[model samples]
Target chain A: MDEVSRKTFLLFGDSLTQRSFDEGGWGGRLASAYQRKADVIARGYSGYNTRWAAYTLEKIFTKGHVPPDLVTIFFGANDAALPDRLNGRQHVPIEEYVAHLRAFVEHIRSVGTKHIILITPPPVDETVRVQENQQKVGGEQEAAMLPERTNAVAGEYAKAVKQLGEELGIPVVDLWSNIQMQPLWQACLSDGLHFTSTGNAAVYHLVQAKINEALPHLRPDALSMDFPGHADIDASSPDSAFKGTAIS
Target chain B: MDEVSRKTFLLFGDSLTQRSFDEGGWGGRLASAYQRKADVIARGYSGYNTRWAAYTLEKIFTKGHVPPDLVTIFFGANDAALPDRLNGRQHVPIEEYVAHLRAFVEHIRSVGTKHIILITPPPVDETVRVQENQQKVGGEQEAAMLPERTNAVAGEYAKAVKQLGEELGIPVVDLWSNIQMQPLWQACLSDGLHFTSTGNAAVYHLVQAKINEALPHLRPDALSMDFPGHADIDASSPDSAFKGTAIS
Candidate 1:
């Protein structure tokens, strides 16, 4: 086997987008949810900035793997990383970040990918662990669950994704708000950098919603026989994951 | 835009298996490789182990992302991680790694990825920084990179895949040695952890070979030049990329 010829979808971004929910990352779940005679390829890395992302992208296509249909991108987490991942506490200006993203998007499009989902990374938890061993940034060392500080970056990044989407006409999925909304997000992280087993599950649902958001018709609503939750004939109702809001 | 109802290929594995060559990871390149005809859904996360891989398959399927024609898997790098990633410093034994990979292979086959490629990870540079960062006890770390060390593990893993292939009779691509022989392998990885921009390109090519291996008839060798890479040539001088190989 010397040639890889699958119709690939390249996922370009930072740790949030890159980290595997092997037991559970959002990408994994999305892969599961969407795995049906389709090929979804993930090409994201953790703790990276847009600069690296841009440079990395070039190496990919120029070397022979070119022309992707969909490229789902979620960067800026590490680009907004605490000083260590960043350049001595210097944050990447939002504008510069956008430029890099645009270049990536443009290149992807140029290579023939018209459909793309530019995602925003879930936020950061500046105060996730305040002990001396777990400290990053200018914030006072205090015990704060990651959801506190990280989601801000997620928010800003998501907003930027939407803006990038608008400018480039690609779809955008804001995982920052979605991930933050989950009470279990903090508990599911592998380290401060990656997701724990459960975190991937949560990320999965969020990404599903985003993909579904991009192609709603594809997910024909699953009909519950006997209206499961309803007190009806033959009541064998496993908890309905779907919260039924009656379609008007 | 409410759902991503597209053809998918669930890619599950570590960095080399996941990293993009230049503009996109193999996943992205894979999407392009197929001309966006298949919606490749990725389940790639960095630093995951066989246990984690096995645990998640059920969750993914139960959630209903299974059932694909292809499930290209290349793991064990993280499983072989010197410091280990699952529990952080919890090194995975070769036996344990083999078991999970076997399970992973079974499940993917069970889910009907008739075209499954059990790829062994590329050799690690014991001299690299990240590998050095994770220098550990026993020759395990050094072994994963070596043909003999991890080769036993690789053999066990590959044998399992082969046995499974013989049992289930699926083809397995021996990426371990082939990748090692490639001229540019070491140049492609940044840290010992994952594939670098250039390294991934070689991977994409290797994967391309796997696909060709599976569907040899699709190769230019099988048929005259009537595919994508074909160009308007005098027929005297054929496609250069295929020069000396097939189209003469």
Candidate 2:
């Protein structure tokens, strides 16, 4: 590919995509690793669920400064995390959550960008609170979610998502199993839910490897472009367009 | 004002605008009585201070599904309600609140639609906790705040706002004194901050009167639109946006 015509890789995820702690986030690392070839746009919002992500996707695609050559979708960590609805102490269900994720996927697909890679949630931590009331809803889906088992939830979600991606004819990077297998993945997690920068880096490198395998003709790391975490991403700068304020 | 063309009055605020209870929120009543016609776009996000309002303004503007010809800005009931940050328990300071309010103003200005109207928050209820902590940084900002002490905070916020409106060449509708004189306004407020529907009605009418006085020519009521509550708005219209896969 021509130096200036390299692909643009956009990362859309939750906290793992945004944490800049130990270093820049996973998206940041992906940018650095593929600095020369791909322009990595990080569209990560901490604590946002699939519903909010679906709502925001429209704005990101339509009003964002520069359109991307490819967009990678990831969420659900927060969708599963429902704060007790104010006063009611009610939680939005996971079934309702899957619907929201589906909507987010549809919204992204509607943008008509052929290149989209759906990534399932990273993994859940084994919390006693998460374990106490864990009930199997039945079938492979229900059977997959065991008490205090994050691996199961990740697996079920990925299975459901694989159906979605295959239906839409888009690729999916199954971060569920990919993350579970990483030797240092568990160690780098900030909580059962979040990740430290190192954890994010692991995910980023994994993504880089996947993208390289999928699009070998277009190696992201070999192209020439700006560093991911350059100090000067101002609101007025073109680079800040994707990272800055709401289009809506 | 012509009967058909009298300016439509729109009420936008917190519980103050909703009229917390029986007060029949200002906008609802204004719609019934105003000759020129007035519609209340009751954007009542209860327990929200300026931060939430700042977050909401742009969304309301961009939605454009149903826009008010004249929009009223009413807050501080909750902004004042925030306890002080230091003791991790003090009232949110007047200056700190002013900044949040300023951000709201900035976002509103950015939208550039709907004529702007500023409504001073209603006086706080006369409560003991608020009275004892009147001088305390965040005490007066919370709902249980008393009228006399909350007045000082309202006065400070109002003064800054008055100056801002004057400087910006916008309209100002002072609710402080008007609310004090009204037997209805105080009666409807549950806490110092939130209003019953009647109180909302009173404020809505007050805003209606001011907007009518300012533009005697436009009738927003005729053009009024409804703000459906968050998708889970009610039992009838469940959020279909995210349909769960629990079809079995």
Candidate 3:
């Protein structure tokens, strides 16, 4: 962290966060927006639930060595899985889900992270999901995957996340509620779980708005641009030209 | 450096590298491809030539602190600008360009960078460049921007880079020649100078191939994946789940 000497935005979450650098994904957009302002590091674990996240937290982020300025934890997608499902490997009950999230937040705050954000799982489109799920897993078992995850169940997790944010006094991005409010919310998800380019754009805009509201100083306009404008560069002493202005 | 404990691929270059995280850009693609294996960090100075890049080397890559495992030096687009052009701000003569590149490679080697790759500037399409330049800068002076950059001129720098790679015993990605060899290479560039999604994909594939050839061990398949599989976890003591397999 001292080596780069720039503010860090650490994103820790599940597959959505893992694929955050997809074509026009939210993470890449954030990276672009924070170009010279800060460094955005994504520590996403696909197919991971809150339990695994809590177990792996200490392994990924230690105290004081490289503390992130802003940390966002997004999970519950896999945790919200139905308990009766064959792939109960990733399912966590609502109570444990809330407890794990609370522990994760407390641990991050204990590490001296000043700003923390908790993003709820987006609403799942079960019809599209079942179709993709069948094609993915294949055979008769695919049709039985009907309610492996439903928007209604995911809504409960979203509500819990919102309540947790209030309890912790941290900012929360209500992706589930806000996304569904959009007229073309269905278009946001590529396969009822992952985000399409449109979905990424929607998240980017929402996240950008939140950053502006909660941490205005981290905004693009607030941070210094890279290398000073080309015209301002002093040809003779190129080093001094960007001395104070550079992102050292 | 020890904080993350993961390998780092540091991209050192001009605007092309700066915009490497753009939608479907190469850097983000590389980062995704190398997820859990290594990190791809961008140290791009937009609108900068090799001269300025040389001046800022020490400031960006200090000795013994967060030394990169693989360093990529990408420039020559700005440097290849015609000497007598209006945009002389970015032009570095062929001789100085080669010398600066050599110095950069040597400096990186001195800092213990295990792998070094020199990426030649992709060829400039003069016809498309003139059109974009006219729209961007505008007015009668636009026409005089005639040879601000030319494929033939950029080819010289690419040749010099390849030659330097031979002298320095490093791999070189001959982007200028290989890209044009593709059908409808003009579609590769978004605005004559920068790459479109197609161009980024082309460069990424070529660079991936080069990495496989030069540093096969760094390939995604070669490096170990992050965390152990979830099914193997000991539910009682989760810490033992990743005893020897974690990203420590």
Candidate 4:
């Protein structure tokens, strides 16, 4: 009945998090880096905002389950949608969004999660978003239609996340500004929202650096492999090499 | 203490399995396909053979833990190593390899695993392996050393795996023969042993096809999302959308 108790790193959020397993995605990169050391679990609900996330918080982080060692809470892109636009149904009032973020942290803490990282939504590309929406609607006639989301509005939500992280004393990856630091940052976004390979790489590097600074013990290199390396095994009597080893 | 229960798919094997989270790896592709439907857990131990895996089976699938819904047991690459070569420490006799494979299935079933898939050792390219080893040793004098593994030897182990699968009434992905079916299959391998992106894609497609044929209900499209999709939510009263949702 002995358990293989590798540490777990959970990613909780919306489509951004859901798509993190795509080729060259941040989540996949993290999983590769932590191979044999920990488990990276993805709990992403696409098209969800902080308000919707609030309703499923307890369900996803149920009390008795083994708590994740580290978690990244990434949200807010959908919450920043313009209230009167076509996608307004996905928007949450700025105040409620901030409150929901706080509640999520409190709930996760109550469930015994040890480390948490808050990632602000990456910068949006308004021009690209508008063009993409126009294409989706299928006509040049809709060219004049207003964009449902704007870079400025997303920036506001990203700022709230940063301020909350400071107030709560939690580490925050300021994705909003960090991504913009890259030359030609707009190219980082594929459809003005989600990431391109470059953007994913940027997020991976940022998160990795944050882990190195805030949770050095969780780094893959710093952790021991679940089992001994093959070179360390006793060739003549392999069982002896694993006889007293703790599976974890 | 309610738990968020998601179906689990476990991948157990050696280095090929260990590196399955790399960009374009079959494991990562599977995870992406099953996002929000199941948790794809990787328990890959590099340079491991059947004998080594036997010692950790119980520890990995402990009695009280929730059994994975599906498990893929992949091995034999290291087991096919020539006994008198530089990597002889990893070799397991063909008879013992087959016995160990059967034991793996029994041990997993004892712990309540529902579905099992076996992936045979992939074909080896002796010329490539020998040249690579020579480069590693950094000397022209080592060029005459025999390869630590041969395609013919690997094929025998693969055949044993297939025969074992039939005897146990389990589905098997005969990677050795399957990869050989590709046009210029040697290009599919990066190092004579490990896979290239093309090889990973091939593995992903083959396993996916097997899932469709034998475990249709476990396919990503056939399963329910852990939570309701955004469009299904009641925007006016968001909580209503999740009021009776099971969150699994």
Candidate 5:
């Protein structure tokens, strides 16, 4: 009984991660790119910060479970929430965020995962965020509420992520800096924080580039197809094609 | 340690199935629809007919491997190939196609999968197929090669699938008939056989409708969110939020 198991690429993070399968999302792009090579799994939890996510680690990567071949640890957007703001419930202090991220790497490694990539949170557009929030509130009170997240604060978290990645010798996708490199970076985000289609494309390209650079062997082109190609199978003796070592 | 295992929806079939993760593909749509509820796994083999797929049943659903909660068995397009044509290598007789489908149902059942949906091949456009084949072959000889598959032949395979589904008491997504009911059904397919964006949208809607009618319990709304919503968490004691039955 030969078992067929494709390589798994797990995405673990918050709403940004959870919504990665939306139309034209980075996760969907990855799934399309790695279609025949790997199974891209989304364990994204909307509105989750590292503190809350900490409890899910044990449950998500259970003991003796076959660890994912690759994992992208994307967080920090929600963690950068202002501690005094309306969305402060989702915030974790900078120090705690760094510590939680480090712990995540260690825990994932301990569970036998071989490849890990860290993605920093993108910059938040305060003006857009304020307007979006106002639309949600739909009243004069909307003006009373301040933007719960700021670009500068999110940048700090992004820097923290880059530093941690350097310390752990893991590749990092500095989403904040990358998206800003584009013209009219504000348009990259749908709301003040979440990604727009352009932002998703940027993430997809960066992730693909990082994979090619740091984990070349895991690239879709580098992996063997699970079965023989139709052209390779003999019409009269199709079963013969499956007899070879190709069906991995 | 609590283990977090989401329900799995496995898609098994040939090229049509394999390409379902494309930009506007049905598989991608389903992945989006079932975002946090279930993992949609695509075990799609391009250019595979039922005869060849029979060899993969054991490898894909091995002993002791947890069976997918829901399975979509979609095939027949390649199986309907005219045996004397260029694509004849993929042809399987109608009798064999039905027998193989029944075997697939039995094998899936033996593995403990509870929900199964069968999708017949969509209608083929012979004119477009011939032109597409000509573009591939090039030159004046393109005119010499007849379309490898005909709508009537594929329809036979589709009918076989419907019959098999009926005998097994499984629901069927009659794609052949459904697509034709749409305006300019030819536009639904990209290259006569494969799905266009419109066709993919059609598949996505039909599959969703089928799930609602035949397997309502598997609907995204019916499933519990794996983690608690952020609004439900206590700002003062975030840890308390994870203590309930919500962390399934």
Candidate 6:
């Protein structure tokens, strides 16, 4: 056995990504899946869109920091805000969203990160969003003027993300289209924007699959475990048992 | 709103703690509970006991690294292995275990972290451990000499941890005693030495309560959220809305 070292998978995004560590959330699933294989670091910034994220990205990926083995860039839920909406401060023009995303990829590359996977935002359920907002604001009259986001707008951002992934040769998880194919797509989102447990599971499955394909050698089973089996430890020098050796 | 600054909750332990990022695991629950508040860093070293962990602790807490705001040190499952067992390489003498715990707490404090929480290992269920080991080793005869751990041994370690915590004036989660108090406590351990999802949930509830009591200001709701509500964003200068302000 050889000394064991750890790699990191960085998950960067907005509220959806921030919530990915919830019970049975995708980030937790990935963390478990990569146990002993890699460190899954969640750098989720809730309510963030591409415009705001662009400012934070440079700060997050500076020269002194270690580069993650893989970085999953998931955004756009807030960026796809409906243009006409008054509180649509989260929105980013589609073109600007694309540019920011590209800049993000370049920045990651500059930091020496080797793998970058882009995840498109999941589709929104307008009916659910409307009803949820109506209850929050007390009536449909006020809700009508404050439709912060629409599925149609989110769809456009998702398309742009997929196109950017292709343009950059990075793998992309097309969550926007893939999630809707589930049996009860509407149940995936608890508040029309954020994910429920079921939605998180869907994202986990897709991301796991993409990882298996893109970085097969770094899969969970492929990494050297940090410690040896109980049967193999040398009792006299317990610490020495794992010092020069890594579990197969 | 002011710029949001997050704290950190460090989970330090063995395999049991390592698996806490699994779906419905305690670490994931904590992460969700602390969303926008803190980063829950899981530093679980599988198959490690107090002796081995003590060696690694110094390396992890060196100066210049960002100090964790809160640290939860949960070990002992592997440390409590029956002395007579052949592969009980994980065992640490009760007195030695107590010393290691103190050293860990001291090291954490030396590095500038202010809060430290200690969690005793959950009790083992011998019947399940035997059955699981029997299936792996082919028969009861082979498993007889390899009773990896016992509830009685774990109980002792738990006592030491509690006593150490009391002397140090640190908050303690007496998991060994509290978990067995649950109905069908046997269901809490998947094998004998590790936690099932049920056990993880039980631990999560206990740790959450202890954190609330010990560090109320660091609780989930007390920390600033990453961004303001969508409705509050000033569209013209959306970035300015969250620039100087932290979501409270």
> Measured against the native two-chain assembly using Cα atoms, what DockQ does each of the candidate structures obtain, in the order listed?
0.03, 0.02, 0.37, 0.53, 0.47, 0.32
- In the range B1-248, model 3's lDDT, one tens digit per residue, is 11444788888999898888888889888888887667777888788898877766775677766678898899999999877765777888899899888888877777778898899999998988787667767847754568579999999999999999998899999999999999999999998889999999999898999999999988878987667556667645666876633221
For model 2, what fraction of the real interface contacts is kept? 0.00
Residue B110's lDDT in candidate 6: 82
lDDT of 6: 0.79
Model 2, range A100-163, lDDT digits (tens) per residue?
6666656555565556777777776655324332432333443224333345655666677677
DockQ of 3: 0.37
Candidate 4 — which pairs collide? Answer: none
lDDT of 2 by residue, B1-248 (tens): 01112233344455454432122334434433432123223444444455444444554555423344666777765555435322222234667666766666665555554577887766766564354455555554653253433556666666776777787777787777777788655675654556654566566577767766775654444342221213333323234432422111
TM-scores for every candidate against the unseen true structure: 0.43, 0.39, 0.94, 0.96, 0.95, 0.88
Off by over 4 Å in 2: A1-7, A20-24, A63-66, A81-99, A128-151, A221-248, B1-248
**Predicted structure 6, TM vs. truth:** 0.88
Model 6, A127-152: lDDT tens per residue? 77777777776665764545668887
Comparing 1 with 2 on DockQ, the higher-scoring candidate is: 1
Candidate with maximal TM-score:
4
The order of the candidates by lDDT, greatest first, is: 4, 5, 3, 6, 2, 1
lDDT of 1 at A192: 48
Q: Give lDDT: candidate 5, residue A181.
A: 91
After the best TM-score superposition of candidate 2, give how far the Cα of residue A245 lies from its true spot, in angstroms. Answer: 35
lDDT of 6 at B189: 81
Best by DockQ: 4
User: Model 3 segments beyond 4 Å from truth?
Assistant: A1-4, A136-139, A142-145, A236-239, A244-248, B1-5, B142-145, B231-239, B244-248
CAPRI level of candidate 3: acceptable
Interface RMSD, every prediction, one decimal place: 17.2, 20.8, 4.7, 4.3, 4.8, 7.4
Q: Candidate 4 lDDT, tens digit per residue, A1-248? A: 13776888999999999999988889999999999888888988899998788778888888877788898999999999988875888888889889989989988998999899999999989888888778877546444377888888889999999999999989999999999999999988999999998999999999999999988998778988888788888878776788753221
Worst 10 residues of 4 chain B by lDDT: B239-248
